[model samples]
Target: MSLILEEISVKREHSFRSKIDVLPHIEVPWHYHPEYELIFIEKSHGTLVVGDCIDHFNDGDMIFIGPNTPHIMKNDDLFYSKESEERVIAWVVHFKEDSFGKEFFLLPEMKRIKEMLINSFKGIRIDGSTKYKIIQLLQNLHNSDYSQRIIILLQILQLIAQSEDLEYLASDSFVESFKQSSNQKLYKIYEYVSENFQQKIDLDEAAKVANMSKTAFCRFFKSKTQKTFSEFLNEMRINYAQKLLAEGKLTVAQIAYECGFNSPSYFNKQFKANTGKTPLQKKEHSY
Candidate 1:
């Protein structure tokens, strides 16, 4: 059984008109579009998978994804809490390439904007004072007419182009392939691992999630994620451990157990191997 991932479709509606989708949760499968995407996640928390990068995103986080990039926003399970009817509000502005025209960016007047788009391949996170301005712009775009909306998008892009607080999120391995298909098996495998990485996960259990035989699952998982199942699980555990260590409250041994390592000695060895530093060393460096 193959894993099923969400696929996002890119639509080219009009030449100059951009589309803004506001939704609780975009249920699109793992897919990419040709146009550039500016997403403002207002009130949501989840593990964001962008290209080859996976990281957690909290409320008020805004990201600019380049054209043809594969990404998804997986909401936290807490979103199902009944007390919160307020859905995940996100403003996704999708615009075609050269929507502003080819000559528009080439002009000396738009050099900075051009440079910013070039840097967007790594993905950019909006921060600090620029956050509110961009948010307001996105809100306004939702109400504006087509021409005005285009202008607002250009303004937002220009602001991102000029902001210094933006940070890139993905690696160079995030090249576009556009070969995504439904991976129900893979999603099940990832879901299980993500939920159980804090405990010992046997290959038998993981393979069972995909309903595959152990040997076949091993080869298939490695082919999809480019890492062995055990390696991926270890990396996830180490990432969680790193977060705990950064908080500076957990003892090394405590963190080791909390992150699912059977013993501190084994945890220390794995930590050093994965991070090139001991747990204490990581904590000190963080400080």
Candidate 2:
């Protein structure tokens, strides 16, 4: 899949866009835009790929992404199954840096917010009491009057600026490469992996996606993602396995093969290596 440049337009009556999205499932592809985004998932289970970092996300997860950062949140396999029904409910706000006037963030009182925004180039995952407070504000944001909504937005930023429970999700090297390079080729490589991670993927085949030889492609992928191709592939498989375990619809052995692991024992080892827990343990805890 090529990187899609999403176009977001603020309504003429508003300075930024803020709303709640309720859908059968999230249909957005891997994409980027010029606006910074704050999103809180009220109800969902998925794998979030931000830049080169891959991780599982659950209900109540919140993240802030800076302008033009590439990201996508792909729901669990069950969400897409024809026999199952699940809904995605989320709060999303998109605003440009100058939404409050270009000079607003440069003011003396805005120092911390300015730094936080800069750090968001790598993407930030909100946690602890900060996430709890933001969830409340996000709920209020969707129904409040225009003037009150703007004030609440600033308050949310102020809270994030003062909190210590934020985690940056991407590496500096990945962010630098992403900004400097044309990402269409990178997106092609990602699309190939996302579509075929459930089967045996050949290095030569992946290299062909980028139009490079195997050796050259290996080096290029590692430089951009900070992980070897095999490591990346394992992480992707393990991520899918996590969702399946959570659903508890299949045996661990079934999940192993479904996630492309030829041996259930090997799947157990890698599952623990990536998640710090075995498949059975994760399945037991999910309930």
Candidate 3:
């Protein structure tokens, strides 16, 4: 696996068309492009890697990725079965900053849209009422003429700009690097960690996966991700814990053990530190 920066032209006369991809399996290799992308996952559930953030995503998840942000969506085992491989129907709208011209966004009418694009560098996940509206707009765009399509796109951007519940995914440090490198090592590392995050992952074992000495791997991983390997693993485990907790089918203790935390008390402590809420508190809030 290698990270490839997808080349995209920004000229309006060479407009990039919206694409509807029906992937048999969600296995996009980690890559990025110079186009702002709005993606809606119609089906399939899996782990989503956006920039340096790692989280699980389910059907109907909608994300707006800024230009040059590395990302991928990997299907989990539950999403594939003997009956059929899970279907991933995604609608992607890609456009460049100058698609409407450099001076377009500077107009008073486009202020909100400009702000939305600026905030998208952090990777926004549209949710609630706004999400439904955007989905509808995307559908209309798919069926409309070129002029109508452009109008719809602008409307969608305006909606996102006004949305207050948009969730940020990537950290500031994970901004675009636009560097190409063999992604095999990072992919293997993430796969191993995702599969066994509930158990202990020693530095020696993880280093071997990358074919580097423990010390060397530590430095390399940190330099690439801007996060210590342990920090990344812990965050991954915590992200799983959040999903499990959200389901409301398990007790906090059960979720702690299920997520691979050695002790329930430690799990509670970390959860609070990461989310600023206790397990029960979060559960109540969710309800």
Candidate 4:
């Protein structure tokens, strides 16, 4: 995957950009853009990394991201398999501070939204009733004329500003210190791990991918992602395993091997450690 500094395309007739993405998988690697973003996932489940916060995202998940915050969503491994029919569907809006005019957001009447936008520098996940409302508004946004879309966009921001269902995804320290210079190397490591996690991974090779010593790479990865390389790898494997278990097309042992675990016993141990449930138990719960 190439290092991406995404450029959001807004048409000359439009002040901001909005669109729906329907794909077999999310292809954007670790990247950032100048525009703030609001994304609502209509269908999907996967690992999402926003700054230093790593978490699982499911259908109906939504988040707002401030300008220049690096983020990525890697669909579960099954989505990448040719035999899997899974799809990812989402609505995304991208706008800049000048979307409404340079000083529009600086006006006294825009204080609440200005504060919310500032807080979004760390990335924000919308939850509860607010999420549903925004999703609906995004739908309306897609069907509206330019004037109406702009109105709906402001309404969406207003709802988010007034609601209590917001959780910041990245940490204060990360937002304070992050710069684009480090992303190319870090994106290499992430892309490498995502592509190779279904087999043995060599620490030396991973370090070389980041152009660093093994010890230094380990520390840098942990500092950026807030998880050890091993932990991140295991989490990726477990995430795929969970998806397979939910599908009920394979035995637990089959899933273990498919997800790169050498022994079912070891897979069971790790599954429970990560999710507090054995593979079989998780399968049962899925049904």
Residue pairs with backbone overlap in model 4: none
Worst 10 residues of 4 by lDDT: 173-182
* Global CA lDDT computed for model 3: 0.79
Relative to the true structure, candidate 4 reaches a TM of: 0.69
Clashing pairs in 2: none
Which 10-residue window in model 2 sums to the lowest lDDT? 170-179
Top-scoring candidate (TM-score)? 3
Superposition TM-score, candidate 2 onto the true structure = 0.77
C-alpha lDDT score of every prediction, in listed order: 0.72, 0.86, 0.79, 0.85
Query: 1-287, model 4: which lDDT tens digit per residue?
Result: 65578977888989999999999998997888989999999999998877656667899899999997778899999999999999999999999999889999999999999999988988999999999988889889999986998899999999999999998876665565454246677767766765676688888999999999999999888887677888777876886788789879899999899888889999999999999999988999999
Name the regions of candidate 1 deviating beyond 4 angstroms: 1-26, 81-86, 102-104, 176-267, 284-287
Off by over 4 Å in 4: 179-287
Per-residue lDDT tens digits for candidate 1, residues 129-158, read 788899888778877775786688878988
Give the total clashing residue pairs for model 2: 0
Report how far residue 124 has shifted in candidate 2, in Å.
2.0
Give a tens-digit lDDT track for model 3, residues 128-246.
99999998998898788767878888889989998986998876544532243345677567656755677878889999988999999999888777779987777777777777777
Where does model 3 exceed 4 Å of error?
6-14, 106-109, 173-199, 205-212, 216-227
TM-score of each: 0.66, 0.77, 0.78, 0.69
Alpha-carbon RMSD, each predicted model: 5.1, 4.1, 4.0, 5.3
lDDT of 4: 0.85
